[model samples]
Target: MQEYSSQAAYDRGEAVCVIGAGAAGLIAVKNLRENGFEVDCYERDTVLGGLWNPENQHSPLYPHTHLVTSRSQTEIPDFPMPDDWPDYPSAAQMLDYLKRYAAHFGLAEHIWYGSEISHIEPVEGSRFEIVVKPAAGSAARRLRYGAVIIATGHHWVPNLPSYPGQDGFRGTILHSSQLKDGSRLRGKTVLVVGGGNSGIDIACEAAVNAAECVHSVRRGYWYLPKYLGGEPADYALARLQRRPRWLRGFLTDRLLKGHRELSARMGMEAPDHKHTDEEPIRNGRYLEHVGDGSIQHRGEVTRFDGGEVAFTDGTTVRPDVVVLATGYKPKIGCCPPGLLGVDGDSPYPKLLARMFSPRVETLAVAGLVEPGVGALPIFHWQTHAIAHWLHIRKGDPERAANFRQQVVSESAQYAVDSTGVSPRHHLAVDAEEYLAGLGRIIDTLEQEPAK
Candidate 1:
């Protein structure tokens, strides 16, 4: 392999391992490699691009799939997406882009594919041990790293909250994960549950072929168009959004107003959920932006009957099939509790600003922050943070310790973050600003001394 950007100063044994080769994981790998760190990426699948790879086991890529966010905002920092690719890249395009990235940087050899990580726990201070088993074999092997990153980004499992009478439904029901094509729903009445992007997309597909379609959401959502004018809707807001929080909120409000009809038609109501959910969007024109009167908007599903979906507002719709797009639960259980050097699910303080494991400062996690402006932007920022922290520890441990001291308190209450119903705990930082801050930190550390 070619020599890294920093060779002699690079720390060995202090090898870092990142799980999953998704968008965030790949970015993390690139940054760490640039710092001359010996990084190993363990991927459960045989390919790059976690959800983008369709042939891998239980991956996400369907004929109908297209990037919800535009290529400009979603691409990695150094590698600009190919000029020939569509403005909104497809899943296959993204997969190819990642493959190219790995090949260009000679990262494929460093990756151990088809290796499923079964468990992870902290060992001695500043170190972690991971138990991994090959997908085709029965044998398990233990590998230790200076730090292990759980870039195994979310969406691994589907979230199906238990509700009344779900078992009573006689017709076939599938989660968004299983519904790869709209062919089966061609002549059937379909009811889509949820208000997120996936739900919106699924409904769009079904309306094209289904006998009829209904979109059900608990409350209203403000959705942004994928594109406005010729660029991404969120791309235009980049300038106006840099203002103070109050001013940013004003711009957010104006964008939602433009998409109100489309949002309402797609089962997204007004007031509570602003268009684009306050996320930045590219302004582009779309046909049938509204539910088209073909996809009816019904607020929330109360329960299910033999052939009926009841709602919280005492309304009910009889549909042939229902597709639930509820989100997923973060799976930290696979990792041991003591990994944090503390007991419980709460994140560690005083370590890479609560981005890495404090118990094992070498260990880091990317893609944990919930989507701020979709998953890619936030995950990109997280990957950047992990990489910067690794560089600091590699050059000088004492200097890094001082920086770690700044984050000793992760929460205002010194309380641990839980997965329960709380938005603030997950989305503490503005994602775009966080990425910008991350870039600045890397630049700063590159100039800082080893003292």
Candidate 2:
């Protein structure tokens, strides 16, 4: 066994350490490099696209997974996806786009694949000591950096729920990530549990491929088609935000009215929040499948009995397979929870401006928030702010102090109303409000430095 030591770390002066080589980490490296900072990004997986790459063992992608948000909104702000691609690109296309982005920015050279950041500690004067754990037989090495950015993302750890008789159930049970091949559903009675985008998409897949498909959702959610009035749904809805406040609501209602009524007519419960509050389901075929009776919409699972499953609504299903499409839990295991301001019992980090760490000056988390839109653009602006903040803090002390307060105030505007108790909702934020706050932070950083 390799002996662990607390020896002095080799310090790389003023270089930043980015955890994970996923989309967020790639963007962080590119943006930080653009800001004249040396960046070293680490990825546990061999690939660079993070969860988007199906080859990644931790990827949450299931059969036929596609982007829910339109391409125009999903692409990185500085790097746009190919215009010829479909509005809602598939998982494969998204991985390709990320690869192209890394290549275009020459970011691959800086990334250390198969290297994971096992631990991080704050050292003298805002610097960080990181332990890089190699994927193979190589001994761990310790290094020091001026700062660290946690871009590991929240989609890796699966959130598996248990029922009363789950241990005794005889049916084949699988998480969403395990059902990568659609052929797994062919000719089998499949029960897809959860109301999130993954569940709906998988249920739709099962509807066509399986002998029977039953969808179990605990609560109601806003179901949106991929398009509205001949345009992509997210694009169409986002455009309404630019309109007059009085006219916006009316226009949004008009666009969503048909889908809302259709969901109600199909016996689905009304959503507790507005369409914009949370990520609305964006698959057009899901509702049509529900309407045609191909996908049976049911209530939450209460228990499992032998080969049968019982729901809260008194309905039971005998399925050949049970697929839990419940989403992932937000986890940052490489560092201490207290460093991320995770106080007493709560798992969610209380980040300043939803990016910067409240307890550590040189630590920040990228792409941790669910901004109800294309996440890549949000990550771009987030890393942009983070890079600029680190740059400013290094030189202009007085301006950096002022900018800190400005970030706190700006972040106050995007407080999300949490209606769901699921751990998945912990990171939810209003995209419009968050983008505005990020813009303000960027403006402060971009301002002229002291004379």
Candidate 3:
């Protein structure tokens, strides 16, 4: 095969380019197509399910990984998951659902598998020039598109923490992604680090499989069971949003009171922030395991000594294996940070309304927010707004200008308070607030033009 010069890009006129064939990307493609735009979706992996597919090298799934958000809340609004499936579907089931979605909407043909977008730069007339690097031993291809939506997601890069003497510690250390099998934890004294959802889930896994399980955390987080009052917890909680504000709070507190007391009884520090401020840990079996002494909870790790780990509480644990479920860093390496409104040295993108780029009009990001609910429906509405925005920009200049102001005003309503939260929670948004914002944006787009 001959290599072509990187001089000219193959022009794809007015065709939208979607990066990543993940659930978000697929939804964007479908929504854009529904809005009458030609779309080309690119997936770096050979598979289309992104992190949901275990075959994807970057997948963070471990054994027995299930949806923290229940099925009714997690499914895409237009494309629901199977009715017979469990309320909390497994990772494999999620992959299957995504595949069915792509097939149902005829989105697979539009996706270019094994094609990774290496770089993107805005060219003349708000169009984008993309460098596509094939996974195979083929020459890089240059292409141009009318617009770009990045759906690459934020879970690829592991946020590993370093402790004193970590390099010299004489024990096996693995990130949650690397611990793909439960057999690795069986019969070993496991130490799970971090306090996020993955850490809690892995601790529960170790509680049942490992000889002993110890969990370490730096800060307290609100923990909620999967169900409340005999219904899915999120659904039950979300239903209160329709009630009066005063009544809603009273009802919410009543639902959460027991769980809060249980954490206190287990010697766990109460969360400093409100439950709505950050993503809460939703696990039914973790507290039970702790109660039974199958899982021991400890404070943050202070240092790593030879074959031993010391905690901030002056306790030391000698574990045969350490698992770092420290969560992931949001990364979009294909585009410039400045273009995404990233100021100074912060890695997080400061997008307008948490989706569109603050600086670039034609560049947008999808599925970047931690909505603390089923993210699939959020992506559906987000892409719906984005597609309509793009369509308005193309055909109705007057309405588009007004809609831009509306979006700016809508974004101000969601000014989040990230105080006391980790940098990883920088992208976190109140799901209720975000959905309300998305609804307003969608209504603006779908409503009839002024008479």
Candidate 4:
């Protein structure tokens, strides 16, 4: 690879380069092609589907991983999943859906599997120079493109927490991503850490599979059941958005009152912030398991001693396996941090309207937001707007300038910092507000240019 470093980059004028062949990347390719731009999508792994595919070495999927967001809400707007599929599809089904999407849109030809964009930087103005590093031991190739969209998602890197004495603890410790099979918990006393969806789900799995299950939650979180009002919970709640604002709150409260009371009865603390502020835990069986004494819910983890874990509530548990379902950190390793408007030491990027870069006009990120809803539709609209914006920028500078202003104003209006400071809430955005912003941007991009 070093031998090829001195060679000039092969310039593909006007072609868009999409990093990662996951759902977001595939959508970007399809949208770019539809908007009459040539596209080249690169996937570091041999397979597509990103984290959805279990074969991907960095996949964060655990045993029985299913969609927290329901089918109607989760499906891509233009490419719906099968009608007969379950409301909440499994991880395997998601991979199958992504494969079908790529095939149906003829996106595979534009994809370079086993190739990664090792580095990318602005070359001439907004054009980008990218180093295409092959997974094989082949010489790395350099290419230049008109623009780049980074779809390499944030779930690959696990956010493991450190506790006192963790290094010498006698039990085995595993991040949620590493606990790929339920059999690992069988007959063992399992301690699941974190309060996110993954933690709750894995704890439920442990409740059924392990001899004992102790769940350590650091803070309170909204816990919604999988179903409400005889329909999928997310879909039902989303439908309420169409109702009058005055009626919406009342209806939402009525729907959630039972679950809220149930959580309180189980000795769980009420969430400090609104449910929309963060991704809520949506597991139906977790509370039931706790009620039945199959799962013991404990406070935050304090420390680790020889074969024992201490909690904030002064309780201690000796578990054979400790699973840390602490979620993932948002990281874009290929591109320079400053290019994504990363200031100081924060790993998360400060984007324009949560998609476009605040610094570079031609660099954008997709699927980097936690919208507390189905992210697939958000990815679809984001790529759609990005593709249209790129097309407009190439042909009409006046419209592009106006569009950029709209993005800046919208970004300012929905600035996420006002929501919270927790790293878990860093990428959080209200789904309704964000989708409306995306719709406005798309509408502006699609409008006729000055005659």
Off by over 4 Å in 2: 1-3
| TM-score of candidate 3 on Cα atoms, chains taken together | 0.98
lDDT of 2 by residue, 362-386 (tens): 9999999988899999999999999
Query: Better model by TM-score, 1 or 3?
Result: 3
Candidate 4, 270-361: lDDT as tens digits: 88887777788999999999999999999989999999999999999999999999889988998999999999998989999999988889
My TM-score estimates for the predictions, one after another, are 0.84, 0.98, 0.98, 0.98
Number of backbone-clashing residue pairs for each candidate, in the order shown? 26, 0, 0, 0
Report residue 334 deviation for candidate 1 (angstroms).
3.5
Residue 173 local lDDT, model 4:
98
Q: What root-mean-square deviation over C-alphas does model 3 reach? A: 1.8
Least lDDT summed over 10 consecutive residues: which range in candidate 2?
A: 1-10
Over 4 Å off in model 3, which ranges? Answer: 1-4
User: What's the CA error at residue 446 for candidate 4, in Å?
Assistant: 0.8
CA lDDT of 328 in candidate 4? 91
For each of the candidates, the C-alpha root-mean-square deviation to the true structure, in angstroms, is 6.3, 1.3, 1.8, 1.3
Q: How many angstroms is residue 174 displaced in model 1 relative to the true structure, after the best TM-score fit? A: 0.5
Between which residue pairs do clashes occur in model 3?
none
